[model samples]
Target: MSIDQDLSHVQSLLDPSEVIPPTSPLYGPNAQGWAVQKDLHPRLVAVPTSPESLARLIAHLYKSHLHFGIRGQGFLSASAKDVLVSMTAFDEFHFDPHAEVATVGAGQTWGAVYRKLKEAAPSYAIVGARTPAISVGGTVVTGGLSWLSAEYGCISDPENMLDAQVVKSDGSVVWASTEPDLLWTMRGGGGGFGVATKFLFRVRPYPQAIWAGPILLPRQQLPTVATRLEAFLASNPDPRVSMFLYIIRKNLLETIGAFQDMLVVHAYDANGEEHGREAFKWALDIPGAVDQTGVTDMEGVTKLQQNVDKSKGTMRQYWAPLFLKTLSAATITRAIELVDELAKQDSAVSDCTYLIFELFALCDAKGSCAWPRPPGAKHVILIGAGCPANASAGQEEMARNLAEDASERILGSRTVNLLANGGEEFHDPVMIWGENLDRLRQLKKVYDPNGRFQGPIRA
Candidate 1:
């Protein structure tokens, strides 16, 4: 059947308000998340308001052999040339303090979850996305990385992901755990099995107060900062303390025009202000630094990080993330040189691009998940570049090439949370699924034999 026939057939099976055709103004906003996703050109969007409706739609698409892509927050890449299943209508939020689990709807944003949890359960926090705008479903299934991960591990870890409510391809809605194999794959297996409607995440006890913020230093101090960071990681500091080192145009966040570079040291100590101050003393003592560090609640901290990490979605963005065992001096120096090279080009890419090195101190405890922290892995470095939305294909390719090249030179493994798109780039299935490749393949066969879902790990 033609794309139009598929869309028309699906449209008749749903409520009028739920079917958004390409001609609708809402189509543009609903179809895209980041600028890079703007061209997916889904013929129509289906917004199912309930699990029954979602299941009904999935079943029709599956049986009819119609191609579709599920979209939650739109951060991840998706193509629905035929139909785009928008999970936005599934927004629901509930917190069971006694059970220590937050039941988040697939469409809910992390920001809303954090704010609500703060009031509903003041002393606890869920292992959620660092950026408030991110959706829970996308972040969790894609291997969630959080500021709290140092203590709790990935949000999708088996221990934290108490259960997931999924609608299988055949239109059956059930708890993922009901099928042990289904649950295992959903726990950070990188989403392809089914559509998750709700998630039950175990929450952790958090103090009412904590210290976290940014410390900006001169760009030339990259060497000193790198040396201190390497030593700090090797010293085996408390797991509660985490840091992110990155270089950005001084004007990237503030002001406009002539751009000067600066190194930002963002530290987070979950243990209240007193212990946090002492824990990050080395960073605090650095001279000529602009310190924005202070004591705040979890919600406050998330908002602060979001303020800087959040993007307008107006520019085309490409990301390359590397998982390294350690931060080496040579790696840091090379990163700075690349930054300099981009600056010299004096192009649009330079004005908005930046490199971030995230330091994750894995909790001693282990978790069963797709990409558990490798024995020695400690850093997840991300090279992100952006370009004008109207730029030519060459300009867009330039942005992607820059990100991919930087990550290759940095030397680290690819992570599903950031790189598994089932696309032209990063095509090695083994790199994404690793040792679990065989097991996941078997599970996919049993759960989705027809390959009704589009997954990155497929052969």
Candidate 2:
């Protein structure tokens, strides 16, 4: 069928408020979230308010040859000519105290879920992203990292994901959690495995309040501080404490606007601040370093999570993960040298940061979810580079090349949340899934025979 024919079908199925035509003023800004390139635009944007309505649209889309992109919070960095489906309106929140589980709609964000949960149930918490704006469905489906990851595992661990309400390619509503095969795919397999309208996450006991925050230090101290941090990880003192190392080249905020390498320690202790202080002892003890630690609630932590919020859609960006086998002084030294090299070019590695994601041992590959930590990897080294939105084409390429070059130095697997930022760059499934690629492919074939769902895997 023609594009107009498809538009007309969607128009007849959903209300005029739900379907945003190409000419609608609301369409342009809504589409702007995912369309990083100015030249790219969607043919149409659809927001179905209910499952029955969304199912109808999916049924129609499946029968037609139209390619569509699924969106939650419009966080995608890629823009295609296909129709974009926004699941923002399918909002539903229900917590089962007896089963210790929460069923959240795909349209909800971690912040929203946290707020709702806070008002209703304060004792339990769902594993999710640090930022409140990030969607629940997108993060959990991609093996989301969290402060509690050491105690538990990735947010999308198969054991924690009890069930999912999925909309099949054929337009039928099926409870995917009933089958082990479908449940495994939903856990860290990425959102291309059909439309998951509602996700059931296993809730864990959360502290009513905890002590956490960042402690800044001079960039010159990275060598000594990193060695101590390596020693801290080697101790394996407590699973509740997490550490993130930020080598900020663009932190022109304080201390005469000088660039510095900062260590932000996160302690999930409900009782004492001693463990968090010990975890980052070397850096916190540094003279002239800024102290930003305190005892606070999750809301305080969410507010502190405003780290890289400045350049969301306003810049041309590239981000990817690097898995480090160990956080040795050698690795830290190599990273500092590379960042210094990139800084010489233009200093675009401003907000590029890495976290000491301890406890990959907690992530067991015995479940159905295909997401696994790289063979011997321990820390998640996330690298990012960004330039102004109006940056010259050559300049943008240079920035991406710099980040890619830094990532090439360390051999690691991919993180799920960042699967969309590969603009015009093809990321091999093998690098992410390894031997599990074949199994994911076979499952994709069974669930979606046609190449309809364009997720991370392309079998």
Q: Which candidate is the best by lDDT?
A: 1
Name the lDDT value of residue 155 in candidate 2. Answer: 76
Top TM-score model: 1
Cα displacement (Å) at residue 431, model 2 = 1.9
Question: In candidate 1, which residue ranges exceed 4 Å CA deviation?
Answer: 35-38, 253-259, 307-312, 412-424
What is the C-alpha local distance difference test score of each model? 0.75, 0.66
Writing each residue's lDDT as its tens digit, candidate 1 over 208-324 gives: 677888887877777788788777778877777887887767656465332467788888888877887787677777776777888888898888767642454567777666666
Error of 1 at 218 (Å): 1.0
Q: 296-316, model 2: which lDDT tens digit per residue? A: 766666667654444456766
Worst 10 residues of 1 by lDDT: 415-424
Model 2 TM-score relative to the real fold? 0.89
